[model samples]
Target: MRSPAAGVPDPTSAALWGLPLWLWVVLGGIGLFGVFQVYYWVGHRLGSRLYASRLGRRLGQDNIRRVENAVRRWGALAVYGCFWVPGLRHTLPWTAGVLRISYPWYVVASALGCLTWVPVTSFGLYSMIWGWLRLAARSPALAAGVAVVVVAAVAVLVLRRRRRRRREAERRPEDTLTTA
Candidate 1:
């Protein structure tokens, strides 16, 4: 195999900011694991008072309750599964800590989650971005159209979700009053 030219990067190898892609993935996994530990400890320390904290208020009681239920039901498994989910990824770990799930199990599950999730997301996201960049280089107009379509789809989804939530909220008070 031929060596890359002086000062030139290898086209076949993925590198970012002078670091190999694998290194970045490893670092990212470690960072996420550390953050998850922090979240767990914070939740553990906060205990029952977590529900009254400013962050808790912002997260909303209903949402925290949902997370709490998931943690209670699934235990450490939920911590692993949360890595695949969007909002739950951030919330579930804290709930696990607050509920005082088995620490050894939590570590095992979280480590597995980091190991699987970071590489998949890192490589997948890198490929998507590079693919977009290549498309942009070849056809700027096509790239712009693709970007617009993605943005529009996300906006539409967000608006629909918001509308649905508003309708739910409107009905909640009436339902509560009737039940009372």
Candidate 2:
């Protein structure tokens, strides 16, 4: 699942069945672009209803206003950057649509954002997963031992933190003033 380049795994670059890396990248990128476009359209189409609905209320008007301001100030650049942020990824595209940003700008910015994101995620996943597999293959016991040590270290840190918190709580001074 790695690219021709050594030590770099690119799932999109990896051929499936009889496919090739370039094809995979192209198809995957297209698919990602389509998805973002759909997201933008949905926002455009249902902008008012979605924003006024219970779900929208839950998202908070203040937060929505902030995002709107960001889009107004930065325009397509905000949408482009939002492709990488989790909640914003969902919100920004729709916001762009709600605000009626130029369609051309939306397409270009969103496409460019997807171009950057899809490959990175695809390649990074492949590298990490395959790399771990290779390491485990080479040293199963060592891998297991390292995992155990990491878990033990985390547990020790948690327990120490709890103990410290308890000691601090016990040392807190009591309030001397009483309410009338």
Candidate 1 clash pair list: none
Alpha-carbon shift of residue 93 in model 2 (angstroms): 0.6
Off by over 4 Å in 1: 1-12, 165-180
Clashes of 1: 0
The digit string of per-residue lDDT tens for model 1 on 129-176 reads: 877987898899999999999999999999998897777667665322
Q: How close to the true structure is residue 6 of candidate 1, measured as C-alpha lDDT?
A: 44
Superposition TM-score, candidate 2 onto the true structure: 0.67
lDDT score for candidate 1 against the true structure: 0.86
lDDT of each structure? Answer: 0.86, 0.77
Question: How do the residues 1-180 of candidate 2 rate in per-residue lDDT, one tens digit apiece?
Answer: 555666655555566679875677678889878887887788789876777766566555656888899999999999889977877987778778888888899999988988898778776776666676777788998777767887899999999978975665456533122348
| Residue 100, model 1, lDDT | 97
